[model samples]
Target: MTTRMAAPMSVTTESLAPSRSTETACFHCGLPVPPDAPYAVVIDGRRQPMCCHGCEAVAEAIVAAGLTDFYHHRTTLSRRPEDLIPESLRGLELYDRPDLQKSFVRVDGEHTREAALILEGIVCAACVWLNERHVNALPGVLEFRVNYSTHRARLCWDERQI
Candidate 1:
């Protein structure tokens, strides 16, 4: 039936939209990055692309210099922020006792004693943080610092707290 054949539909090809170029940020300077950048620094513990190794080295130098504000800001943009312990609690005691049944040996004054605690279940920074935090919260603690790499906490405390 060649009577009224419907005209053939013409198919049109749709072009794809261009993708947006990703902007790279420098780890140390917070500057715009290029595609061919080589070295990158850890910005707030996150890796970032850098223009060159010198720039990355400079950034690392800044971090090593104890200027962490920049890194902190950059890290906040992409990662969870860390909770730093209060400076007041940096050097504090948890507990100490001169005559306690189960306690570390003393080498100094009764009020000031050094104890090696066999910390159990300490594996990460969080564990160190928790143990140090709890230990420092004690009334008589004078100083407490944990060596996570060694899984131990070195504590100095006033005997009264025990």
Candidate 2:
């Protein structure tokens, strides 16, 4: 089965013409922000195109944390969206914690649980394929799916192997 979600909001433009592809530097990651990108965020008073929602969210978080100086001092393009996720947030094991699981997970059968996640670094169909492949290869993962349009994942797995 396929599911669809609403696209993210975009700032309006005066012209009704289709946007032409142009290579503009991403304000957050310093990579080439394609002309037709669907996600964008305002940073330091200017609106900038973000390659994906992950980049936009990360940029927003950085600016909100008052760490804007990192952009000025950085010498290279930003790391993969997955790598940019802070160490504190990488505790996947936390899902096993009862308190946390109560909020985002649902019990299916005796040994299985289902959950949804918003994945980062998924910018294309290839990314969706790779993520699904890698995650499905895990020991107890019974099902793994990635939605390229929304960058959302649906997963089912055995609690014991998790």
Candidate 3:
């Protein structure tokens, strides 16, 4: 049986729009606006408070570049600067979940696990060697073997440090 997933809910422009009378947070990232923060960006014919010059610049860039649709359609607000992760790294985070890990990783012992991975973008022997060396250099990795012909790699790692 297939599980049905609900579509992501869209955020309304009104919810993200700044209420000048009582607004105390950055409209772009949802961070608390400092008491004397003078940063703001004009969007949808209204001024929106921003937490910092950084947010103001980014928001202004987005508006100037005609990317305001992101503001209206975002399901969740942006996080604080320190809490934010790079967009490229976010997709790799799914591998950390136990459910996803189960599919590729096999238990070898209490502290050891093995993973069969299919690597992409490999075109030559140097690429395979570079990948093998990089993965094997990790602290808890016990071994890394790769098949250049198939672009497949088997990795053994320690669970506690991995």
Candidate 4:
């Protein structure tokens, strides 16, 4: 008896995934979202597709911080998730929002603000010192101090300069 073999078939994400329009992009990084892409984050009470786990993590952090406006004010798509940042720096721009500043900043003068901040992941004196030094070096930073025991940071700055 002679046996017949079937032809080889190739499959891509588009083929395996459900159908979607070509215009759909990742809400976080502007990458094209594969039809089958499963990673997503809820933003503004709607599901937003993510390009990868890194983007998803960053989005979740933003949403958790009540900075969903970060999505609204962004001028450019974020960098590739792998290239984003240290956990602490990922959402720096979100702080520009007045709502976020309200949580930590006290108006000390017409142009100055003092922010009481909780420094996360600071486990040692060196970490506190490093943070203090760097923050103090920033332009417009009038003062910066970190308490090793409490990981609380008090920062004074000229809002116009930084």
Against the true structure, whose lDDT is highest? Answer: 3
Backbone steric clashes in candidate 2, count: 0
Pairs of colliding residues, candidate 2: none
Which lDDT tens digits does candidate 3 get at residues 1-162?
A: 995543433434345545565658687877678899999888767788888977897788888877777786687677666567778866897898889999999999888999999988899999888778867977899999889999899999998997
Tell me the TM-score of model 4. Answer: 0.45
Candidate 4 wrong stretches, greater than 4 Å: 1-89
TM-score of each predicted structure versus truth: 0.35, 0.45, 0.46, 0.45
In order, what lDDT does every prediction score?
A: 0.57, 0.73, 0.80, 0.77
Model 3 global lDDT (CA atoms, 0 to 1): 0.80
Q: Model 3, stretches more than 4 Å misplaced?
A: 1-89
Candidate 4 on 3-107: residue-level lDDT in tens?
Answer: 543332321233323345665677777777767778899887778887777688778988887777667656667777457468877778898899988988999
Report the Cα RMSD per candidate: 19.7, 16.5, 14.2, 15.9
Ranking of predictions according to lDDT: 3, 4, 2, 1
Per-residue C-alpha lDDT of model 1 across residues 80-102, encoded as one tens digit per residue: 11225566665544332336624
Candidate 1 Cα errors over 4 Å, as ranges: 1-103
